[model samples]
Target: MKTIHKKNTTFLNLAAAALMVAALVLGCKPNVSNGGEVQPPVTDGCTITMSAGANGSITASPVIPAGGKVAKGAEITFTATANPGYRVDTWMVTPTKALTADGQQGDAIAKVKVTANTTVNVTFKPIVYTPVAYADLHNHLTTAQPETNGIYYIEITGLTAPDVTGNSIRDSASPLGQILNSNRQKKVALKFGAIAGVTDMSSCFNGCTSLVQVSDIPNSVTDMYSCFKGCTKLEHVPNIPNSVTDMHSCFYGCTKLEHVPNIPDGVTDMYSCFEDCTSLTSVTLKCEYLDGKFHYAFYDCSRLSTGSIKVPADSLDDYKDNADKMKAEAEWFAKDE
Candidate 1:
């Protein structure tokens, strides 16, 4: 009986030794209770770290705790937000955690499954606007409203000139017209960028009652028919392109226009070009009227009396010969060279 009890004790000792070896292999230790019974090993929670790159901020849903520790199988959500002129670029996860809800680069939301400690990072990039190619660049702002100060600020680049098919900026559907018709007393400031390859600008600013200034017209333009007509408050104008051949009713009803550039010699049509320009003081005629008449070109110019108009000395007789056709007093422009 004593030999049998000794054998039982030896078997219990071998079992305890095997349990210790197995615990070492599994990266855990057996815990002994007060009753000397072995208990399972305990595990600590994992950690998650998040960071945001420049020009943006990152946040997590359900809020990481104060210690940034989470359960081994918790699902964490991350969202990235970009500042103005910026956008989310990419996301990176360290140690290759399981992503249950993955998103491509530039997407703002993602979900990650944390099986181990991991670090999440997000990067941002700036937004760049590419220049549009030259073509019709009009009427895009037709429905845009002005700021509180009653001014429309606009910027456009690569604008090719429009043909005579009523595609000009002064057409009925034009934004410039909308801006003025919304409040005819307000002013508009416009800026142009890189204008090229343009040949026509007919009725470009017609009926813009509050326009007070304009940028230089490109020299490639050849037409100015009714271009600045009905700009009642415009006080100054850029030089007319030397390539222009038409000025039909170009400055009609310009109540505040104060000066006129020398008419280009290429002009072939000047009919009523300055009619009803109530504030025009003087003008010089360089166009010789070779084939076209200037009938009523200066009609109803209340501020332009006799001698207010000037003609080149070389063209005075030619102008005088056509004075009846021009509807101007022949003596009004014959003295000045």
Candidate 2:
């Protein structure tokens, strides 16, 4: 019995040796311990690191814990969201390997494979904005007029947000032709984004009789000729910039406007500026009196009595004399406090 067991053990040992020789000849290599025992590669606790660059934030799906460790070959999905006025610029994958939807379309979401220790980085950058020209807006709206937030608005296709630069409307050749004058019957409430370099605003909103509210006048605008003429429903007047020189017929038919801000000193033309403003009661002038320019400036403002026009204290007598000559008896010039 003992001799038979010995033979069986020797046969098993010989068979193992033969198998090892065959494996070596076939170029098959397996990890072996110093004790001559075969072992498999360890795959536990593999990790994927992720980070978000400036102007954005990142999140992982299936909820990687604080340690961020996972089993090898586990799939993780990442979603990057940009801050306001910004967009994802690029996605960086360290030790690049097989990935799914990896930003080829600038998509914010991507799937990552945890092969070895892997790193996924997402970078965000401020979106470069292109200007919207008058012609560009005109072309888009000619076929269809779109409205947003109660405003007849148009945005450039690629821009992430709206930014009105001065160069946008600098090429406008027509100022007195009522650039944005729309049908008087439709109610319009204008809310302007920042406008930097406009100098001529003549008749820009002219004939927009239904215009009720307007905000943000460009500080660089100098000519406001008939800018809001015939806007009978307009009640609030945006502060006029000091760069203006011509306000001829600026608010000629704004019947609902009751108060006027200090008229800038650079104005040289006020002809019919506030004509037919029947509801107007107060006006403050900062500009020096110009002969004949004040004529008909407040022609039909019945509520604007002679004492209601406030003039600079230093120039009160001269403005009064000019007002008398200009036949603005009902809008008599008074010293401003």
Candidate 3:
């Protein structure tokens, strides 16, 4: 409680300051580097740098992205996506090593190991491809007839999908309908281009009795009258494009087709659409309405379960009671019955 002398107090304060300095020096010594400078957090990792080859970007996985770091021995993948009109031509990796590559051109991707600091260089080039054009092999001038063997054969080998949507160029305007049949010569393969500008598919394959296979059709089609009426051997029918509105007798006599794809809401006329599809078991006609025009649409779909008409579950009664009620009744009869 008594006042302390200044000389004695100064000596005690100096000793306290010495202890504090010693504790700090011990706590911080481990973090000092050889230069006596505080070091950054240490890490055992490598850097991976990716840049555009030509108007495109290179994406990677398991690599420190965006000027970052990844652990050594990590497996990394770099994928190239070329911009429009450009394609990936080559890759240049600094400190080069063997790389496992996959995919083609503009969509190429490669895998490599992270051993050292690396730089990825990709080169891109202009893409070149043949302008696709389709020619109708059968129509009014060349009715859907078969070869001397009485069978039609279609081989679509090198065709690829088009970039445009809902457009097609029809090879023939007045196609007779059944020319797609497989003539004992070979299977009918239509891997051809998507006929985008085409709008009419009426009677496209109507009487193809031996037509067992049909490729995907263009989504630009609108008319489909009597398209597959007599494709008796076709077991499975692909979905027609949603652009179709005129469905008059589209599948009238396709005796072996088992199901009908979803009918789009745009459809207004379904006159005799499935009149004679004898083996038909189901249909997806969620299209809320069918004004009397489809009365005989299912006339011969005898095998179709009453429940097979897959409408919105809430509107089953409405379909049977209102939309084309006559068709609901005609669903019982088959060809010649």
Which candidate leads in TM-score?
1
Tens digits of per-residue lDDT for model 3 on 238-331? 5678888888877888887765667786787888888878877777774555567667777767777645676655645556665345445423
List the candidate 3 regions with Cα displacement exceeding 4 Å: 1-189, 313-315, 322-325, 329-337
Off by over 4 Å in 2: 1-180
> Mind sharing the TM-score for model 3?
0.46
How should the candidates be ordered by lDDT, best one leading? 1, 2, 3
Q: Backbone collision count in every prediction?
A: 0, 2, 13
TM-score of model 1 (CA atoms): 0.50
The whole-model lDDT of each prediction reads: 0.69, 0.67, 0.60
Q: What is the per-residue lDDT of model 1 for residues 306-335, given as tens digits with 9 covering 90 to 100?
A: 778777677788777776676666766754
Q: What lDDT, from 0 to 1, does candidate 3 have?
A: 0.60
Minimal lDDT window, size 10, model 1: 129-138
